[model samples]
Target: MNSLSNQSRVTYSGTGRRKSSIARVRLIPGSGKLIINGLPGESYLQFSPNYLRISYAPLRTLGLSTEYDIHVKTKGGGLTGQADAIRLGIARALCNINPENRSTLKSEGYLTRDPRVKERRKYGLRKARKAPQYSKR
Candidate 1:
C-alpha cells in the first residue's frame, strides 16, 4: 500500500459575515467532514437541526457534500447567524476552486452576504424605534 504522504495537500479558504457574526472557512479534499470551533458540526449545532442544514446547504446545492472537508472558525452573534456565515464562507471557498460555480451559487443565493444588522438605539427612544410611553394629562 502507498503512504498518505504521497498525496499533495491543497486548501481553499474564504470569509463570510452576517449581522455581527463572522466566519472563516477552509476546505480541503477529503471525506465529508465539518469542524467548527474545534467541534464537529452536528455536536456544536445539535441544539438546532436547522442550523446544521443551513451550514451544509451550500455543499448540498453543489452536490459536493462528500467531496470536501470543511473547517470553520466563527465569532460574534448567535448560533443562527454563525451558521449562516459559515454557509456563505463555504460557498465562497467552493467558488475559489472554480469561478464557474459562482453563477450557480449566486443563483442559489448562497454567495450573497446578509446585510441585515441590529439598529442602534436613539437617545430619546427606548430602542431603535420604540418610543417611550406617551402621556397626556
Candidate 2:
C-alpha cells in the first residue's frame, strides 16, 4: 500500500492555447473527472456533448479516459476554443506522464496549438477584412 501513496501524489501538468483561449491542465490519478475553473466540467461546459468529447479526446485515444482526473483553468475565447485548448492541454499532460504517449498524441494532432486568431480590424474596414462596398460607377 505504500507504493500507492507515492502514486497518488504524482501529478502531471501542461498548458495549451487556441485562438485567444488558454488552458492550464493537470492530470491526477483518480476516477475520471473534469474540473474547470473550480466548477464541474459538465455544467461549466454547458453539458454539451461536443465540448465534453473534445476535452476528453486525448485520454480516450490512449484508452485511459477513466484512469485520470483532469483539472483545468481556462480563459479567453469562446467555448469552442476553450474546449480545444483543454484537449491539447490534456494531451500534453498525458505525454508528460509517459513520453511514449507523445507519438500517439502527435499523430492524432492533439499536441498542435492552433495558430488561428481573430484578425485585427483595419482602420478603414468594417471588420477584419470587410471594406466599404465597391463602387463601379
Candidate 3:
C-alpha cells in the first residue's frame, strides 16, 4: 500500500495578486499545516485576526481546512494584501485540484483577483490625491 499512498501525493500551485502584493502558493496532501515565508501562518500574521481569517477562508468554505497543507511565499504590499493574495492563491489551487470547485469559489468571490491598487502620486501632490496647503494670499 505504500506505493498506492505515494501515488496519491499531489502538489498544486497557483499565483495570486492583491493591490501590490503577489503570492506564490502551493498545496500538498498533508494534515492542515500552513507555512508562510519560513514561518508558521499564525506567527507570520500575528496580531491580525482578520488577516488570518482571510488566508483560510477558501479552505474553510470548502470544508477542507484540515485536509491539505499550504505553503506560501509572498512579497510587496502590507499584511492585508498578502493575506488576500494568499486566499486567492489557495482558491485557485483548489480549483486545480478539482475543477468543480471553480463555481463555488467564484460565487463566493474567492477566485476573483481584487483589482484595486494604490493610486499613483501625482507630480505636484503631497499624496495620491492630496495637494500641499493652498496659498490664497
Candidate 4:
C-alpha cells in the first residue's frame, strides 16, 4: 500500500553532536555497512569496539538490521566522543525517516548531546592541583 511504499523510500541526512565532537551522517537503504569518510567498515576497528557499539546501538535497537547504509564524517574529539557524536547523528537520521518515532528515541536519551569534558590543568601543579609532595619539618 502507500504506507509501505512511503517507508521504503525514506532516506535522510543528519548531524550528530556529543561533547566537543560532531558527525555528519547520511542514511540510505542498503545492507548494513558503515563507511567513515570513504573508508570501509574494517577501518573503524582502529577505534575501540565499545565506541563503535555505542554509536551503532540505536540502529540495531530500531530493528533496522542489514537494511541501511551509513556514511559519516566525524571530527573534533577523542574516539569515545566521536562515537557518541555518531550515535546522535544516526538517531536524528532515524527520526527524519519516521517522525512518529521521535518520542521513542527521545525517551531513550539519544536526542540529547552530552556536554561534559575534562577541565584544563592549572599552571604550577603536579596534577591538576597536587601541589607536588609538600614536606615542612
lDDT of each: 0.92, 0.95, 0.94, 0.82
Q: How accurate is candidate 1 locally (lDDT)?
A: 0.92
What CA root-mean-square deviation does each model show from the true structure?
2.8, 3.0, 2.6, 5.3
Candidate 4 residue 108 C-alpha distance from true site, Å: 1.8
lDDT of each residue in 52-87, candidate 1, tens digit only: 899989899889999999999999998989999999
Clashes of 3: 0
The Cα RMSD in angstroms, rounded to one decimal, for candidate 3 relative to the true structure is 2.6
- Which candidate has the highest TM-score of all? 1
Tens digits of per-residue lDDT, candidate 4, 1-137, equal 98998888756888988778889998899998889878874476375677778878888778885879998988887777878888899999999999976888888889887878666688878666667777797
Q: 1-137, model 2: which lDDT tens digit per residue?
A: 99998877989999999999999999999999999999999999999999999999999999998899999999999999999999999999999999999999999999988898899998999999999999999
TM-score of each: 0.92, 0.91, 0.91, 0.77
| Residue pairs with backbone overlap in model 1 | none
Q: Rank all candidate structures by their TM-score, best first, as comma-separated numbers.
A: 1, 2, 3, 4
- Candidate 1, after superposition: displacement of residue 13 in Å? 0.5
Give candidate 3 regions above 4 Å deviation: 1-8
- How close to the true structure is residue 65 of candidate 3, measured as C-alpha lDDT? 94
Which tens-of-lDDT digit does each residue in 76-126 have in candidate 3?
998989999999999999999999999999999999998998899999999
